[model samples]
Target: MRNLRQKQASLVHRPIAWHVTHWSHDVYSQGAYSTLLPGGSPAHRAALGDCLDGRLVIAGEACNPKAPAMVHGAWDDGIRAANLAVRAGARRVIVIGAGCAGLGAARHLSAQGIDCVVLEARERIGGRTHSLQLGPVTVDVGAAWLQQFGDNAVAREAERLGVRLVGTDFSQPLAAASDGPVDGIEAAWEALRRGIDRRLPLTEGVARYLAGLAPAEARATRYAIEGNLIIEACLPLAELSVDSLDEEGVGNDDHFLPGGYRQVIDHLAAGLDIRLGQPVARIDWQGSDVRVNDALGDFCICTVPLGVLKTLQFVPELPQPQRDALAHLGMGRLEKVVLQFDRRWWPRSPTGYLRWYDTPASWVEWLDLTDAVGTPTVAGLIAADAVERQFSGRSDEEIALAARDALQAWACAVEAVR
Candidate 1:
């Protein structure tokens, strides 16, 4: 048999700087985003956010059905929760988990002449929308992209906040792997997916759509599936629901925050009462007023991520539907490893994604952030089982090495084609 060493041959060029995230291991997030199970329903998200006892509500990306697992969704849900609190005659409100949702809720509640305070377990605000300074530039380590930017609320917010954004064009074709000559692929892919059997997983749906694709088209379709869909879902396709394929965000433009996404977080957090380093241990909500830790409020909005919510203690336990919502959904891991070399070494691509389809492990997808972040940097994205293996205690330098090896493999493949 051919030696498996060929599968992950290492490159000699060492990176000067590196950053990797283990959102799953994070005590705050637990995982990067909410995972849509094979046969999950948006109703479950509704159930999760359902207001209880007219004094408690859950708010987060997981609570927004139209746009779950999105930063704007969390922010929007927080605002929605704040409105609900106002309508319910809440005098004072306590918002849990100072993420986009919490900050958004606090901002809205404070504006509405209501007394509100936000409790955060982390030392800083922004939560999942985090940024880190690397060399001379600031890049987002948490939620980075302003997806579907044209109508994205965060995109508009970025503009008002003066945060710089660089557009991503994935179809530039220089760095991406095979799966060529598939015209109308996006519309075609969506059309075929519209009637996917609901009982089965997304893998089955993809299989049905790819039943008799041409050799070239099949390759490209698989690349798109593995590089785009799988990466977005943050789970192996088999674990995703066919329904996930049915939904698409309204717009198409995806932009990176050149100055980092924290600009939005900082803007929303301004003029709000937020308490940091206060982890909520239990919520006692059986009385007329809800009690979260030592803070009590006429109403409470819990914006905790779904992964953390599963283990959080609630007094009298959540209703059956909410508990069932927690049981039905799952959290999928998506992490990034940033590798900055002394100089640009790999083949250049238009500012977008470089997907190496030859091997779908480690760095299956890479975002060329050189132009976006103004440094010789590339962000390698890994998901699903890759997350488990990396976070099991792998160091950032080791992850950088593995990512560099994948870049070597991609370079070799590109040379062969030329």
Candidate 2:
């Protein structure tokens, strides 16, 4: 058997990076689950959460047209459902799926002196807001950060719960796989911004749109484009929508709760009845009466995921248009890979986000978790279509190996700059 020293020596000399490191992957089937595929357009939103015969009301991020796939969107939908329930004279509310949206609805209804029963298919609440143990430290597996402070429900709840938050550094730190760190990448980024400013109605995607610009051939420009368009948006350049870019008004004040996002889940779960391990099979509703198994109520609010709801049985069947909307609106695929290292191998910069321009895979943007989690850890968040093609069916080991190899290349590239 090779000793640790021998193993370390072999790894160093294997044309990889410096010292060998051991890492573990914690993968979830619906990890960072978001509906990013087709469906859920404006036409679909009309029936997404509409009350059917004043007996069934749908809720969740899927119902939110303004901010789908966001925790805040789900939270807001819960509030809307609570109001709808009160207006409909619901004696007791049945909230399906104890996710952020469901819990939010239950919590608000409870506060309003209304009664609600929340049924969760999974054993725990906080649907996508899952936090898991990674080696020695704990990290969020889903819904990690509060995007902004301005009127953000997540941030407000965090403050109320007294959950301390650490602001994530969004400063750009650019590096290329073949050329290492590009020292003057910001200048190129500013030039690209100038070009973007000049192009008013950008119909095409960022990658092609930038390519049409004069100086897009510069290596630094591509780095900037990858970091800004691809990595930041979590989508490929071609798929990123330039039209909705201006619609985002939330200033860059994103933060992560070090105490774990589960704290938020616990806070929202207080004083609410949540039945765990109870998978809802079907919804039978008519004329202000809803039933799921023996759990009967005057009205039902479905906070279940679109993906999960699509598979469930609905009695009397929903309208064809509603079915079509549910069929078309897709769940966007967003996955995260977290690796805990023995020590910090990458450069210690104030930059929070690092992007590798030359990497073809989705592990392009890496979030350094050393400062936040107090571990020599890094988490890679991939949101491009390539994620589905590359990582969908692969096991945790396969994905981790891919991540390790990518990190190996990235470390070598960053090390060369030093």
Top model number, TM-score = 1
Runs of candidate 2 exceeding 4 Å displacement:
1-43, 174-211, 214-251, 388-395
Native-to-model Cα distance after best TM-score fit, residue 206 in candidate 1, in Å? 4.7
Per-residue alpha-carbon lDDT of model 2 for 1-418, expressed as tens digits? 1342243334421211111111112121232333333212444654677877777888887787666657788898888888898888888999988888898889888888887899888787888778877766678877777875565797898898788888876655545454444555667666666566324333243455566756534666666655554444444544434432322311267788776788888877987999998887789885457888779899889887776777678887987767876764544445677877777776665765666655455566677878887878777766556476557577766776666656666666665556
- Candidate 1 residue 208 C-alpha distance from true site, Å: 5.7
Query: How many clashing residue pairs appear in each of the predictions shown?
Result: 2, 11
**CA lDDT of each prediction against the hidden true structure:** 0.77, 0.66
lDDT of 1 by residue, 350-398 (tens): 6556766644455667888897777898888888876666556657777
lDDT of prediction 1? 0.77
Error of 1 at 297 (Å): 0.6
Residue 395 local lDDT, model 1 = 70
Model 1 TM-score (2 dp): 0.90
Q: Which stretches of candidate 1 lie over 4 Å from their true place?
A: 1-11, 171-196, 203-221, 249-251, 389-393
Best by lDDT: 1
